[model samples]
Target: MASSIPLRPLASQSELQAFYIGKDINDVPKPAVILDVAIIRRHCAAMLEATRELGVGFRAHVKTHKTPQIAHLQVGDIPNTPANFVISTVLEGETLLPLFQELFRAGRPVNVLYGIPLVPSQVPRLAHLAKQIAAGSISVMIDHPDQIDHLRGFRDIAGFAAGVFLKVDSGYHRAGLPPDGLNKGGLVEKIITMEKEGVIELIGVYSHNSLSYAGSTLEEGMQFLREEILGCREAIRQHTHLLSARQAKGKELVISVGATPQVVSIKGLLQGGALSPSRHELKALLHQEDSDDIGRITVELHAGVYPILDMQQLSTNTHTGPAEDEIAISVVAEVCSVYNNAERSTPEALIAAGSLALGREPCPSYPGWGVVSEWRRPKGPGRLIVQRISQEHAILGWEKGKGGEEGIPLRVGQSVRIFPNHACVTGALYGWYLVVDSSREGEGEGERVVDVWTRPTGW
Candidate 1:
């Protein structure tokens, strides 16, 4: 089972004084989303290093943070090299275009992939935007063969080639075609015919192994990875002839796979060199022959939530939950009500953070909406759990003896920080993040509001 840091009161008098010298934690309004910048950078650095070591390209899914500053950190400060990014909404793509344009003007290529399948209505605007920014810099996903027609029409009308990827279903059963027999009915053949006609450019195949998140152990996650690779291999095999034909015309194929669970599992394997055994097998399966005959296969890993972990991420590995320093986001809420449940032999407290603020997503294998940690020291395991949540109330509970001999005496005005079950959704509930440096937290300095970064919300 995963646990939270021990409960501690808000900053002490002296600590509060020190924090007040700048900007204290209590100074911020209640039900605020707090982000630790240091932790996010560390996580991004680790992911970037691991991917670089494995000789694979990384395309960070920006939907998790939806903030350009954090997205920039994920892509790194490298010059000239293109920063690959994936987004879930059209608005996000539009919002990031200016930033991508700036990078392009500075000589660094930046590519954006709208991960969601395109709707006919959205094509004109998307196509126009792609043209204005950088030709072929924006890509979209196409799961169904019919979507190719709409894309082709839009491309002809817009007078530019649009890059696209075939979405392969890797047991998630959510928006993608099955890898095996994908060429049935000459569907892939038609797509290739269109690519030959300059209607659309088939960039690669993409998959999201969401089932990997349900894995209770790292071994289970690895098994999911195997399934994903096998599925992608089948898809590649189905498109081998068509892809080879395109390659002859100077086109490359990308094999992109990820979700946080799969990406993190692969990262761990790469770090331990456990993936070395299967590297040759994967390379053999993914390789294709071209005219000049140098097969171009770029293994692109995409993930979003790994940068800012949550309770669900912590519970993924049962052995030693996520390190205290790894969790970068938390909800700071104040106790609104406290009740003594003599009959149940436990005390309950209501917090200001509720479903609206913290989201209703549940943590697997854990019975709580959020894990409670000390407001001042959020790095340890917590004793109280958020048992229930209403529109504006989170009911926190703990067993009588578990809390203390006298039971946890929570005050009405007391404030505590909660690690949400799902950071992505919880973060969406807030407009901006109250940024803080984790290192300053232990120095008797409360969360000083160093900076505030606005988050993009809505569809």
Candidate 2:
């Protein structure tokens, strides 16, 4: 460990102690999204391997999991290591600077981009902060031609060319320049022209593959760039004569192609009978400079998985409960009302496990539903009941056993915390988490708790 940052402000040791054990907040009931550190490191290593094989730089975006501890690991050692990072929000950019400073103190250089913000008032501060850190290397994205007006006078005011990357749509209609269109040279021409005029330095051409959009897949993303890169190369070639005409000059241009998903998936597209290089060869290709001609660029895999582990561990017990199953999480709630006295007046009680946070909606997971845990209801006892889930809350109900008793009983003050099917989103919803350890049961490593870490919320 290279000296740990002070944990005081980042998290409270005592609260951390209580969180891991899956304790409730105040006297009211509460739940947590547990994270496993080992699981995150495993995924990070896998992503790094995939990025390296694609002949592009691997600058893990820390916006997904905005934890300093994880960011340090992703950026490497600086001067001795490569410091390439892609941040989404300004807050993420600010938070990352200190981590970079730490690396600088130890003799490392950090290069990072907090994507690009369209608003006008943001440019100056971003530029200033970039200058403050070692290898500050701040870059932003530009999509439309008119947006450049917001940046007008930037050259006169800043005195230095801004590092910028042109945003290519790449089949994802979310935001960026379409791979091809009448607006063909729209944003790209403006950016390159600005660079030629010394307003901003066009470092590279990049794309954002909004997988959630139409025609955006790993293959589509790569193929889209293949054409765009070829197109841009031709555009630049056409400019050769114009260059001589205007006596203009610029260095070789580079294009950066990737989204977190496609970045790792396109590594094997060129493989064949005997014409393909081994994975190791591809990794080497991506890490080298001046090698951009070989379709090389950086891929952004924001550190989403890392946070799932280093933050909190979801609690899952395999033991049987007093109900029909041993490993089920039972919830008891009153029927309140049942339309035609169809049900009892007693508060409903049920075996609650996975809830809406787990991606289960319209209908919640019924019995035999297991996530993070593998438990089942027993064969000999209480009513094995499962019911629907409400937004932000779940309602479980059950009738009495084989006997003549009424429905299961749960008082007004009783409640149970559930383990989420997907822990990542759940983790993002809270500012801090309660932790508990399996080995120590109630004690060990002081109660571990994690603060709600995140990148800048606004652009």
Candidate 3:
């Protein structure tokens, strides 16, 4: 994908939206991608106000920037957070069916889950992505016991029955089944004999600290989201006597937990959602979450680069505070050449976004693969990072003692933003997303271009 790999947009979405929407992200072309949209609505409304202050329930994964206007700002237009999506491709849940059919015509009822696992050629494309929301809104994700006979052979060829979750691997073995092997792992009694033969429809118990990006602080990411909510409430307390009690409660059971550095370390709590008395066991499971039954269990969280944060989520310092105030995606690139490192004279510059547009991911905090974004300059004692990449080249330098023997000040067509090191692999090599908006109002307000989302490419 080279010859000047412009991943997409060979113009024509009504001429690139009549030529670069509101125009600016360096007036387009140069490894573009941009995004921002007011820090993607302040990091998806601060992760839905920290899961409504720990009452919890919020899925929103969309494989990072699969894009439907950031999956409608990670499901918000809240009517008490209705959309629960999770999709890791069935064409990103059928390209988010027109934003879940316009949140099922505003009365809001969207649900999709199919995050992955239970693969019988993805059951007729999740029975055609559950023919549009509602018969238990298409969930999936199993951990074995032959995916409960692949959902009882997809309820014997789509007569309906695809709503499950199970998946427990609390320690991130990658997939699931391990909250102490959920009651002797017969895959939870073959998913409790197909949810007592109604075929399928369990929907609860998912886990995923994905090792909280090897967290560095914020109480080791709130103790890995308090051990992913005590490993999904210890696999939903080992099936409260083989299920069936309105099939579980706590807003009807869904104890999910996932990564984004342990769900953004619950915004380092304190200030009402409290928590730090040496964290009394994650403050009695996230600030007395209503005192028990894991608070009626609906603790979901799932994440996806929490609205475009990167640099390995600011090197997982857990409370990702400042990377130009929470990254929110960037690439823009240009300054194609200005070298000087002959045996370490240290002073470089290259940019044209490498690793095919800023991504070969690797941010053990510093020593780069992208950073240089001083959020539109004027705040630099010494920055400029990237420090070397290849597939389409990068370089940029200066960090060893924050270099400055007075030399590399980049020039050739200067334009730079960068901030990468994995905003979901620098947004899967961009296929359109120039949008911007640092909450506008003056001096380079995040370089104009207020809209052009697109992205919904190959699985």
* Cα RMSD, each candidate: 7.7, 9.4, 17.6
TM-score of 3: 0.36
Tens-digit per-residue lDDT, 140-210, candidate 1: 88876667788876686567778888888988998888987666567678778887888877788888888
**Which one wins on TM-score?**
1
**How good is model 2 by TM-score?**
0.60
lDDT of 1: 0.73
Candidate 1 is scored at a TM of 0.86
lDDT (Cα, 0-100) at 163 in candidate 1: 83
Residues forming the 10-long window of minimal summed lDDT in candidate 3: 1-10
Model 2 stretches astray by more than 4 angstroms? 1-29, 53-55, 134-136, 152-159, 182-186, 212-252, 266-372, 375-389, 395-425, 433-459
lDDT per model vs. reference:
0.73, 0.44, 0.73
Candidate 3: C-alpha lDDT: 0.73
- TM-scores, one per candidate: 0.86, 0.60, 0.36
